[model samples]
Target: MLEQYVRKILTARVYDVAEETPLQSAYQLSQRLGNSILLKREDLQPVFSFKIRGAYNKIAQLSEAEKARGVVTASAGNHAQGVALAAKHLGIKATIVMPKTTPEIKVKAVRARGARVVLHGDAFPESLAHSLRLVEEKGFVYIHPYDDPDVIAGQGTVAMEILRQHQGALHAVFVPCGGGGLIAGVAAYIKYVRPEIKVIGVEPEDSNCLQAAMAAGERVSLPQVGLFADGVAVSQIGEHTFAVCRDYVDEVITVSSDEICAAMKDIYDDTRSITEPSGALAVAGIKKYVARSAIKDQNLVAIDSGANVNFDRLRHVAERAELGEQREAIIAVTIPENPGSFKRFCEAIGKRQITEFNYRFHSKEQAHIFVGVQTHPELDPRSELLKQLDEAGFPVIDLTENELAKLHIRHMVGGHNDAVINERLYRFEFPERPGALFNFLNKLGGHWNISMFHYRNHGAAEGRVLAALQVPDDEMHLVPEAFNSIGYPYWDETDNPAYKLFLAQ
Candidate 1:
């Protein structure tokens, strides 16, 4: 079976569209980590992703009749672009079913490649179901994003290039795992050719399909997947890929969304390339691995798989990168209402730069403040800083590791209304522009009184708003109307666990 796959990978005709991207050295990252770090620059491919290799290989292997009949596939974004570009090159009509929740930039990219675009459900699973129907009804050949043997074989070409480019004493290659296509293919090739070189798989903790499959000893469906790394937000690993991973892959490692953001910054510092969240997964894994293990002064390789990132999303990434790298520490502090309390807090902080500060006067007795302080990235300063604050008699709560504190509560601090009846809190995302906040309030504020509101501009294209509205249970119908009329995306936080624990009355 492995020999057959080797044949398929060797014969894959991907160069008609895909490029043999370079394996570039990340000098800055290497220096910082105290290890030689090489980045497999798959992000430089024609579609800004290695997906074109698999997509083009699958399409090229098709019979002339099959090509004429056309192909259909469901994708979140990167694979759609790949299939679209491959179809365009082959002069084959392609129908791409993509999630409605896919970024507008990615959707437009697929359409620009001259494919027939169909916006289906909100995620890959639903889009897959819709595409399968098209395959059955329209007589279109289905080019699955990652499952098929041909696609996996095509993806192996990346490992082939990696070996040829770097002939040094290679320690390990970290491949970002999604549905397991890339890692499976790379592992198969590397393990066959160079058995000593470890093939590690990296995945986002929330969407670790490959890791979960390996643990189960078979392919298993995830109940849900996080959309932060939308490119690799697969619910399950493909059967073929899972088999390959089970046999050839050494181990799988998971990293968080914040770590991925920091990896993006690291890649940018070295390669000047802004990678998508999933694209930076391997880099994040490398950082985590270095910190966890004694491996040092050794050669490490990470597959920087794609760069099809939404420009607006970078704002959020930039905001979280510092925290992920441990360069910033967030803490909740309580100070007296007296005039010299803030001065005393500043003196305690010493010379460390404050990244952010949020405070509201809740009572005459005390005031709570959300503070972000810069610190050494490699070392955690939370404990020492908290100790200092404790010794100084200032109360402190470490909000750095708190998810709810970082995402929602930091913005929603104070202004809790016990007087307002039937108050429903909502978290909303609106297109960021001049007067976006005013427009949101004006459009949604019909007779429902806005009892509480909290918003802070992170300079992203979307503005997140936490709002509490006063409306009676009998007038619940007005809530939907307000949302529909506002035309901004909103999620009810009235019963949100975080809201209940932190902000709700």
Candidate 2:
């Protein structure tokens, strides 16, 4: 049935789109899983996604009278670009309705494709309703992004290419699920050709409409959708696509946002390609299922569905990648307030490298310190570190699991000091080479006490250092010259905007 529909659409459309994408083998993933792993590179398509195939096919199949009436669509990101580009290629006027909060980059890309972009509502459903209203009022053809027969048929071309490229060696195929168009098409074709090959559907655990619908044995709407994987953040699967998925897909898996970030990094490290969180879903699901089922020495294929990620989000992905692997720990340790107590606490930590340290001398009797430590994989080093501190007669609290400690305490340390003393904060920029920070610490005059300091080597040529010092009120003016003479650029907190903001809070 799907093949017949695909043939009909191919015959109706004058444009050719079959020769663009490639099916590439993933060497790193295959070795890691002990299986022959292949990647269907729909990400390499002209629009950087498989959505174009379906969008173009659907629009091409319209009757001549319908084509003259123009087109309208509602999409969050990738699909919007697909529709806009397809309309431009076919010489059809298209109006795309997108959420107001859609990324600026996506909105610009849609406009660049010669489509009139309308920012409406706060979510896809609301924008979709608005688009439908425009279709009715202007007599425009509403091009359903995923629910039509032509769209599903066009998407099935991915499966056809996969079969030709891999030659039936696949034991399982993983596809990310949003509104289920891509998965529905792929599963229908793969099941028809290779009934033994398992068809797995993947979804973000936070917005898992397909998984929930399959469990209930019927379509169900999600109460809320997660925007982290914005490309696949669908609240409900389409009726036509869900019908194909219900009959063809063998299993469905849900992956967390952290897991998706890890997968995105993995793909970048292996293939040097940046994939959006949605594109990484298939790879994440395959890795998760292989570990869960202990499947070894089998063939696997993961469809890299799209690569339309915003570059600004990469920083957040990099920050959370290590935590996903359990290779780092953030904790708070309290030590004695006496002289040499800090040295003893450092000694107790032994061989662990301190990634971050923030502290304040609270009272004459106690000091609070927040520290982040690098730990061996597969072990909670916090318990052992705490035990050693306790044995050394220091009161230690494990703030490893404290959300507040992880988010805020590390950055705001010096505010807890006594008001009797005068403290000055300075921002210092210095070279990032080894021991540069230590050298700055060593140059501090003995009379001036170090109150608080925070520095991180961000893999840049230069490093930023924020330090607070407690000194006699008369010595405050001399501190800037002290840093300047040492060839370090420094800014006093009195005139720093960040300090004013923090003080205001």
Q: Identify the candidate with maximal TM-score.
A: 1
Error (Å) of candidate 2 at residue 476 is 46
State the lDDT of candidate 1 residue by residue for 1-505, as single tens digits. Answer: 7788878888989998899898899999998888999999999999999999999999998999999999999886789999999999999999999866566777889999999999887446788999999988999999988888889989999999999999889999999999888988898888888989999999999899888988989889997677678788888899889888998999999999899999999999998889988999999999999988968899999999999887878888998999889888988787898999999999999888898888777569887777899988546476788888889999887878766567778666663456767888887877555666887888777668887777876543356788888889999987787687776667776875445534666
Give each model's whole-structure lDDT: 0.85, 0.76
RMSD of each: 4.6, 12.5
Per-candidate clash tally: 0, 0
TM-score of each: 0.87, 0.75
Candidate 1 positional error at 494, Å:
9.3
Model 2 local distance difference test score: 0.76
User: Which candidate achieves the best lDDT against the true structure?
Assistant: 1
406: Cα error in model 2, Å: 5.4
lDDT of 2 by residue, 25-129 (tens): 788877877777778888888788988988888888889999999999998688899889888998999999987756677899999989999988755678999
